[model samples]
Target chain A: MDEFSFIDSIKPDSYRQSSLIKGIDDDAAVFRQNTQDIVTAVDTMVDGIHFSRETMEPYSIGYRALAANLSDLAAMGAEPAFFMVSIVIPSDWAEQELQEVYRGMASLGDGYRMDMIGGDTVSGKEFAISITVFGYVERNKARYRTAALPGDILFVTGTLGDSRAGLECINKKIDNEYLIQRHCQPSPRITFAEQLSSFNRVALNDVSDGIASEGSEIAEASCVDLHIAYDSIPYHSSIAELFPNQYQEWILSGGEDFELLGTISEREWPEVQQKAEELNLSVTKIGYVSEARESKGLVYLTMDGRTERLEKSGYTHLQEGRD
Target chain B: MDEFSFIDSIKPDSYRQSSLIKGIDDDAAVFRQNTQDIVTAVDTMVDGIHFSRETMEPYSIGYRALAANLSDLAAMGAEPAFFMVSIVIPSDWAEQELQEVYRGMASLGDGYRMDMIGGDTVSGKEFAISITVFGYVERNKARYRTAALPGDILFVTGTLGDSRAGLECINKKIDNEYLIQRHCQPSPRITFAEQLSSFNRVALNDVSDGIASEGSEIAEASCVDLHIAYDSIPYHSSIAELFPNQYQEWILSGGEDFELLGTISEREWPEVQQKAEELNLSVTKIGYVSEARESKGLVYLTMDGRTERLEKSGYTHLQEGRD
Candidate 1:
């Protein structure tokens, strides 16, 4: 089918929102939000680099592409409003495959109450999808990675290492449904971010490049030192049971968990924890921010109680060959 | 270089605006505009399909990718604010080549006072750049292609067929600087759009997919028939001087001129023409919107004064194989 026909077939009428002035069938999409601040992010996923067609379904690819961008907005304590997707598919791909991709995106978009407003569909030598998410936050309420104070307590929402473990499960042909699902469709911690931002959290970031990398980023951005306790870092229960030996490595260095990692003041820690409990979320206090000393930035207390510098290494696409 | 290092090295310190709350080094970029309405557009350009690496520079590729999206915003009569780029580059490309791409985008971004806010860079089998531009238009002042009425005069900003002629020059090794530059870096009609929109255009569209296709689009959207005069259609001077035989074909069916095409009521035509002249822009009256009858939408008059139905065939990516 042609481009227009394909777009028309998948166009969702339910995407209309009061804020949207215009949607598809125009040169550009128009919208309005009352909030004074807007959070925007763009992410691209390549077939071989981000996922493999052999392992992932087309729907999962589409879902994960938007999930990655939504995760960025979540980290910024922004409520997702809408997103645009630009997809370049291989010439050989069938119309059904493209439809499935949109279906997957619609499913996730519906859950987030965000619309797929506008985008471009083109032909390329390989399959790639680029998603741009727009979200809103009140002025001065949008969280940043540059506000963690020396006395801030660090916390993370949801378990880590599951996505990495899921990848391992797929590679090893392990029959771990949860692990594979986690890898294929990791959820963005939007609600957790909303709850934490309501309490005016300090620094915020999503654990996309492993806890180690994210911790260092917060430390560098806020001009502070981070002290993480290895035992306090929450690992997926499946990881501990299925691959106990790799739990620490996966929890500290594994990526694509899409969990919110942030810092809060000591005074607000109790209330933040209570709020997380109210939200029925698994929020864990795993570290503390301190003034930069001789060995500035990320330092970790090992399981054996020895302090060591945490390496700023994780899922750097240029180095690791994947997102 | 790793992803972090590459991102840090090219990170523009000058991108910071008073409206930009946060930029790179965070999970997402944050910004706010005082305008009540926001306009967004996205376009993706593939390396081989959109422009071959042998014929185009990396910088031109980057510039054109963003330019395409900006053109869409221009068609909406929006003021350019910021844009994000998601790039997938082959692993074999040199770091300098990648830097050149950013430099190209930075050049255009600086011209429009638009920030390169945030995006993702990943490895792909081939090079592709997807750009999402965010702009703002005053509420009720934004232009649309669906608002034209019967007896509205069609006017296009700037000369047409230059970009296509430029492409032909490059393909045939014609060594025409004007044609080549027009093809490589066609300017988006933002200034013209800003001027004409002040006069309240009835309908608007960018001439991306040839005059015939765009004219048909505006006609169909507005539910009116467009009667275009063949002699009034503007062609670039270079096309007339260098390739006179192909001038008609290029003006009628060529794509990627990035010029604004729109309709204005006959009552507003004089004021619109004055505004275009004040802006030093070329605005030509080429057609008029008529009430839809049996053969509704688009029709054209030949040079000999004979009428014919205008075909909707232009640059459909699925049929043409690329943008």
Candidate 2:
């Protein structure tokens, strides 16, 4: 099918929302937010680099692409309202496969109450999808990485490194379904973020590029230093069971966890913990933020009781050597 | 350079705008507008299909991608504020070339006073960029393709078929700077659109997919028949000078002109013409919307007074059959 026909065929039933003044079939999508500030994010996933037909299904590809953008919104404590998806498909792919991709996107959009507003479909030599999500946040209350203050207690929601472990399993053809699922369909911590933001969290970011990388970002942005306790970091049980020797490396540098990494005041730590327990979310307090020392960068206190400089190691596009 | 460093390097100097609450460092960009509704549009351009390195420079590729999205916002009469760009670059591209691509984007963004707030960069087999633009329009004043009325006078800003003709010149290695420039950097009609919206134009769309395709879209969406005068449509002088025989085909079916195609009330025509003249914008009256005739689709009235059915033929993704 051509671009127009394919778009027509998958024309989603107008899932109307009060904020959506206009949806598809227009030059641009129109939306309104009475008093809240708007939060917008865009993320792109490419075929071979981000995902591959060899390791991922079309549905997962679509789901994860949107999930990445949604994770960004989640970090901002925004309620996703609409998303636009632009896809470039290789000619060899069947229309059924493309439909499967949309099906996956629709399923996720339904869960988030996000309407598919507008996008473009084009042909390319490789398969790729770029999703832009629009959401709304309470005025002046949206979290930012630069908001972390000295003496703030840092916490992370849910376990990290599962996605990286899952990727390893896929590459090695391991038979762990949990790890595989984690790798394929990592969840974005939207509900947890929303609850945390209600308490005026200090700073927040999603664990997309590993804890070490994300922690460094928060510290750098806020002109502070993060002291993380290696032993205090949370990880999935499978990490210790299957990759015992490499678990620490994975926990520190494994990317794509999509969990919320944030900081809060020491006084509010108990209340934040209680709220997480109420929401049935696993919240781990792993570090603290402090004024930067004279000559040191991010500090990692290892299990061996030794302090070391934290290196910025994670999944970066050019560094992957995948030319 | 890795994605992080590259993004950091090009961090645009803080072009402070009152509406922008947060810029590139945040998880998602935040902005505010008191009463105006938000408008968003996304467009993607890919290697080979959209433009090849052999025929176009990286700057043009990036400029055209943003221009396409800006054109959509222009059609809605939105004042461009921010745009997020996500790019996938093949590994073979030098870092300088990638920077040139961003230079192109920054040039266009500067012209429109649009900020590049947030985006993602990744690796891919082919180079591609997707841009999502955010703008605002006065409440209930945004134009829509569905708003065209039966007696509304159809009009288009600037000349059509120039982009297509330019493509032909490039393909044939003809040294015509005007045609080539038209194809590479067709300006979006933002100022004209804003002026027309102030006058409450009936309906509007950009001429991205030729006059016939865009006209038929407005007609079908509004459930009215558009009677277009074939010879009355405006064209570039280069089309007549070079491809006289094919000029009609280019005018009717050639795509990517990026001119605003709109309609206005007959009573508003004289004032609209005056406004266009004051703005130094060339607008041509092409046709008028009419009550739909039974079992007949969009109609084309030729110069010889012969009526013909208008076929939906412009640029379509898969129809081009480029693998």
Candidate 3:
């Protein structure tokens, strides 16, 4: 079939939102969401660079691609409403495999009522998927990394290093279903981020890259120093037992965690924990923001009454810096 | 540099619109435009599948990629506003060459005041660029292919087949600067489309995949038959002079024209011509819509008082169909 025919075969028959006046039929998709500000995030995942067939199933590949974009919106405290996907297919891929990819996305998006409005499908040598997600946040209420202030308590949602460890487990052929599932299915901290918007100001960043990279970003953007207590950062017990020497490396610098890392005021820290508890989420306070000293926007790891710069250790694609 | 640093290096230092609350610094770009309905179009161009270094310059590739998406929004009569880009860079490409790509997009977008809001940059094996554009149209005023009715006058803006001929010239190592320029630089009929949107109802489509595919799309969507006069279809004089035998084929099936095709009320035909004259746009009355007679939504080409079905003649990626 032609590109148009394939698009016709895959386009959603009916959209859930009346606001989505146009979907895939027209030259462009049309929609209006008037109640709040609009937030958009676009992410691209390639076959070799982002995932490999040996390690990632088609469904998990699709799921994680959308999940990464969703995590970005979650960090901004945006409620995702609509998404568009642009996928490049290789000739070897079957039509059924493509449907599995869509099914994977629907499994996640249907829960949030997010509609797949429009996208482009084309044949290429390598398989790649690019997803652009749109969401709404309250007017002028979208959280930013610059919102952190001195005396704010730094916190993270869920355990860190799970995704990186999970990826290692998959590569090593280790029999750890929990770790494998963690690598494949990352849950964006949307609920916690939504509640975070109620606070006066909370600097939020998602842990796609390791905490070292993410914490450094927040510090640089807010022009404040972050003092992370090394012993306080949480991780899965299995990761420590299985890879004791490398567990600290993964906890500090392993990427693709998809957890929320934010700095909130000391006064509101208790309330934030209570809300996380109410939602049955694991919220851990690992650090605090402080006025920049000695150097601007630096992150320090404090353990055993000794302080040292937290070095970025994750793999970087084009150069020697953590993601 | 790493992905984040590369993004920081290329992101716009300042934005023209206050509606853009956030740009590249955040996880997602946040913006609010309350005046009109939003229109979004996304297009992806790959190195080997869409174009190659042998036939296309990096700048033209970038320019044409954005142009195609802008043309989509134009077909819907949406005023272009902002766009985000997701690009995959191969190891061979230099940073300067990448900047040229951005320069190509900026050359067109700056004229329309469209801002580069946000996107992701990643490393991959092959070079690819996907652009997602956002525009605004008057509430419920956007045009669609389904709006055509019987007795509506069909029109097309600008000459067709130049791009296809240009591609042939490049492949054959022919030095025809005019055709090559026409192939590389396609001016979207945004001004004409904006004017057309003032009418009550007009069915519209962009001549991206040639008139055979585009006209058929409008016909099928509107559930009407289109009678196109073969003699009235406009083409560059050079095409007929240079390749007399294949000119008709190119005119009918040559894709990437980036011109607007629409059907409007017969009463508004004269006014449309007048507006075209005012705007210095070449608008041709080549056909009219009719009730579906023998076959629903079929397109017939008439020449010498004889009519024939217009078959799709362009190349398909995975199967046999145009575009």
State every prediction's TM-score relative to the real structure: 0.94, 0.95, 0.95
Return the TM-score for candidate 1, rounded to 2 decimals: 0.94
What does candidate 1's lDDT look like per residue over A1-323, in tens digits? 69878888887676646788888878999888765688889998988888888888989988888888889988988888888889998988899998988888888878878888888999988999899898888788888888899998999988999998998898888999998988889899887787666665568889888988888888888878988887888877889898877766788788899988899999999988898899888889998889988555654544455566776774232222211
Residue-wise C-alpha lDDT for candidate 3, range B20-131, written one tens digit per residue? 8898887889989787899998999888877886678878988888999999999999999899999988888877778788888988988898889988788888788999
| Segments of candidate 3 deviating more than 4 angstroms | A1-5, A311-323, B1-5, B312-323
Cα lDDT tens digits for candidate 2, A275-321: 88998889999989889884544545445665666766642321232
Q: Candidate 1: deviation at residue A39, Å? A: 0.9
Counting only residues 3 or more apart in sequence or on different chains, how many pairs clash (N, Cα, C under 3 Å) in candidate 3?
0
Q: Per-prediction DockQ, in order? A: 0.77, 0.84, 0.76
RMSD of each: 3.9, 3.9, 3.4
**Could you give the candidate ranking by lDDT, starting with the highest?**
3, 2, 1
Report the C-alpha lDDT of model 3 over A82-197, residue by residue, as the tens digit.
89999888888887778778878888888788899888887788888999999999998898999999999999999988888898888889878888888898998887799877
Pairs with steric clashes in candidate 3 = none
Clashes of each: 0, 0, 0
lDDT of 1 by residue, B1-323 (tens): 58777887778787745667677668888887765588998999998888888889888887887788889999999889888878897888888888988888888878878887888889888999888888878777788989899988988888889988998898899989988998898899887777765665558999898888898888888888888887898877779988977776788778899999899899999888888899888799998888987655654544555566776775232223211
